[model samples]
Target: MDLDRFTRQSETEWRVAPFGKMRVPAVIYATEDLIRDMDDKVFEQITNVAMLRGIQKAAFAMPDAHWGYGFPIGGVAAFDPDEGGVISAGGVGFDISCGMRSLHTGLTPDAIERHKSELADALYRSVPAGLGSTGKIHLDPLEMDAMLEGGARWAIERGYGRAEDLERIEEGGRMAGAEPGNVSDKAKKRQRKEMGTLGSGNHYLEVQRVTRILDQTSAAGFGLHEGDTLITIHCGSRGLGHQIGTEFLKKMAIAAAESGIELPDRELACAPINSPIGVLYLGAMRAAINCALANRQIITHLVRAAFARIFPDARLDLLYDVSHNTCKLEEHWLDGARKKLFVHRKGATRAFGPGHPELPESLRPIGQPVLIGGSMGTASYVLVGTSEGMGLAFGSACHGAGRRMSRHKAYKTWMGRQVIDELAQRGILIRSPSSRGVAEEAPGAYKEVSGVVDATDEAGLARKVARLEPVICIKG
Candidate 1:
């Protein structure tokens, strides 16, 4: 957090000059205060990332950069396979493909108020939540493999959601290269009953109301209105993702020595992209991505069913689904030529700019929807990718208001009952099995989302579309 450690490149950009063992410089996009507020671990991790093999461009961090397991949570680094690129397990995080999925309810804020409590209770009863939660539907070994391979498409085929919903999902709800066989049996078993369940810790199902439109054009394109109510689910591949990360992190750590790659940090364990171990990790990681997509799809179905029980005529359509903490093979323009690179985004969201071929046809003109969830009892934002961001960050943006304090610190300083009561006083409803969980996610435990989004836009990572205030929050 020492400003003297970095040289100012511009108002929003800070540079760490490449030195000892670093292959490239590290760059961070943030305002002066945000940078000063950032944890020192972030700078250390970014510099470590720069020393990795085949690193293309500078290792970068978004405005929400904060200390994480290995890399800074809001980290972005691309590596070229042709240049002996290495795929890092730490860069992907433990909860693989953890993401946000937003739904558009065809009702206004006033309509939600009429049956808010009923809807909240209904959702709580219908959607399994909290630690070790299980859903009504269970997957057998064969069915689990199918779900991991087919993703949301398989869930839709099994009557979870509509066929049309796939259009709004990333990779059409199924990431390529998913090999269920590559995943460990233990990992698959852990996820057997977790689908459609919102596992604890940062995962939640929130109902929000659009309070303001920041960009009329993009907001219109995204089917947004001032008072429209929306529901957003934030989760990941449950225990399966965690198991894969734990298993592979150890494998990569051992392989790093065998492969003759010097690691600046042991936590940044990695393997060559073409190595056998790396290939297996990619296959297993892709399966985890599909698991997350399928999980969100099933949760969306449960949300619709819960809403129907309250409002018979209610219609909740998919807005967009995006995953963070992923390493995607994407084509990015660098220097003068287009190169295929494995872009690792940890605690960051992909913000593919307008007209990118990877986007769905309907959203191509406006670019991909970037869902930015705020902390508990806070307001979230919707943003769209911009051409400027594509040029700057390989079309990447901040995922949320990154954590400002540790969970342990929060529990020591605040009480769950007080936090819940304070939020309730502000007309925000909170429902959770664990009172301590609520305190750990207190709004004060995170950086200001508005400032993060403003810095993101100022740095040309993404353009804000609409701001949404939480009406009901069902945290895990």
Candidate 2:
């Protein structure tokens, strides 16, 4: 937090020179105030990340960086497999592939306002949310494995979403190399009935209106316009992700020593890139990524159905869907030669730039959409990736406002009913099954999202296209 601790590299870049066990330097992109308010543990965790084996470049943190288990929540680090790189379960939190998805509904804010209350109630009723929520759709063993392997493509084949929607999602909505056999039976059981459910803790479905457009060219490319009503889904691979993370974190811890990894912290449990434990974890993790993609695809169908019941003419189209908390194998030209590295982005969004082969043809000229979700009752933003970003932090950007306070601290300071009532007075509708959960997600507990986005844009991580203000929220 103390600017004195780091050397200024540029307006939005700060460098922490490596000392003591660090193998690389640490870089953070944030304004002074955000860094000042950040917990000191972020510095320690990021420094720890620099000490990992086979680290390429510097360990980096985005503007929304915060204290987290093992690596900082907004951490970014890449390792070369050829250099004996390792994968850490702690790098990917409990909620594997947890990310945000935005939908473009062919409607205006005025049209939505005409029946806002009814629409809110309909969405809340149709979308299963909150803790331990289950859906009507269930999956058997064979079907479960199929979904894991097929991802959103499987959901589309089952008539959940349109076939064209796959192009808007990362990895064509189905990550390759996903082996369902690597997923444990216990994890599958937990997700059997949670196919279309929104798990609790920072997850929600919101109806938003584009309040502003920062870049007209990019906004038009993204099919976003002022006052357009958008539906945003924020969730992940329900119980399955948590189960995989839980099971593997323990295995990785025991396997670390055998893999000859000298971890500075036990929480950063890891295994060599080629180790059996690492291979199995990757397989299971990729499958979990598919589960998250399929889950969102099904939820998109549910949203369309709910809206269709109220306004049959309303058309909800996929904008883009990307996952955080992943270790993706990508090639980047480092020092002169192109090298394949495993880039771990925990609580950070991938902002692939224009002309990148990974992007869809329609979006190749513009860039990938980096959805930055705001806290409850706040305004989220849509930013486009920039070529400059690919050189910084490996095309990574801040995912959200990031928590300013702990959940326990938030609950002790505010009551859920009171927070809900205040937001309602501002014309924002809030619905959740648990008041305690609501209190834990109070908007005041987070940093100002606008500032984080500003820092991100200033740092060249992404370019802001439009801003979305929440009109209704289905909380989990």
Candidate 3:
């Protein structure tokens, strides 16, 4: 936060000197104004991440970077196992696979304006939300295992979504190496009836209209044009992912001490990547990723059904879905050789470049679609991955407009009722169980989304394509 103490790399980039015991220098990508607005603790936490073992390149922070449990919420880091890389629980936050999924609505905004209220009501009724909300599907232990291993595919098999949907989802809707046995019974119990439900806090189902086009070629490739309607779903693995991260952090601390791993911060407590504890955590984390994918998949079905009521011929086609959390074993060029690295992206989206074999066939020509959610009443962006992203960040980008103030601060400073009324006046319909919840996610509580996306594109993390403004917001 002290601009005078750091070296300026650009208008939106800065470098902190090598601090005590840091293996690599730390770099932060944020406008000078945004940097000054950040809490000082973010610098401390990012520096702590720089001290971690086997961390490759630099400890990087995105434009939306903000103070978090350990790593900054919008942090990106990759570790090499051959160099004694470690996997930290704090690297991946409580909301495992908390991600965004966008659906392409072929209709223009004019086509849906007449039925907006009807569609919003239908969506609010169809999708269960709010704190402790449960869905129609309640999975038993045996069935839950199938869901964990199957991911969205398991749901598609049961008629939740079409097979074509898998091609647009990250990892084809199923994360490899998910081990349901590693997840505890309590965590499983919490998620049993939570499938297809949108949990509370910064999560919502939004109806948006493409308001601007930045790249004609990319926009055309994505079937997006100004005035086109689209649906964006934001949520995660719900209570189960939090439980998994909570239970394992305690176990990892003990493992860290036993393994003689010296952590600069207790929150960075971790285990060797190949250790028994690490392997189990990875397996469990992947299972949670699947849970999130399955959760979003079912929600997609609900959104489609809700739209069908208003527009009889409406069919919601998957644009793209991506996960923001979890440590993955990926092959990247490191130290001039192709070595497998364990990439940990906490609050970061994987921005795979064009022609990457892993990308969905439809997206191969245009690159992966990076959905960056904005604060309520703000403009969200549709970006595509680039080769520059691969070189700069191992193909990673900011996930959202990061929190400017904590929820506790937002609740204390703003009136929930007033916030709801303010947004409603702007033609944004908000449906939530608690007025206080609305206050906690006030747009003022987040950084300007356009600024964040601008920094992201400048940093070569992703290329901007289109901008989306919410027409109706269904909150939890």
Task: Provide the RMSD of all predictions against the true structure, rounded to 1 decimal.
Answer: 0.9, 0.9, 1.3
Please give, for residues 1-476, the per-residue lDDT of candidate 1 as tens digits: 99999999888889999999888889999999999999899999999999999998889999999887678899999999889898988899999999999999989778889988888899999899998679988999999999999999999999999999999999999998999999999999888889899999899999999999999999999999999999999999998999999999999999998777889889999988888998999999999999999999999999999999888887789999999899989999999899999999999999999999999999999999999999989999999999889988799999999888899999988999999899889989898999999989999998899999999988899999999999999999
| Model 3 / residue 242 / CA error / Å | 0.9
Model 2 bad stretches (over 4 Å)? none
- Residue 471 C-alpha lDDT in model 1: 92
Error of 2 at 141 (Å): 0.6
TM-score list, all predictions? 0.99, 0.99, 0.97
As a whole number from 0 to 100, the lDDT of residue 165 in candidate 1 is: 97
TM-score of 2: 0.99
| Model 3 clashing-pair count | 0
lDDT of 1 at 186: 96
Angstrom error of the Cα, residue 220, model 2: value is 0.3
Instruction: Give me the overall lDDT of model 1.
Output: 0.93
Q: Relative to the true structure, how large is the alpha-carbon lDDT of every model?
A: 0.93, 0.93, 0.89
Compare candidates 1 and 3 on lDDT and give the better one: 1
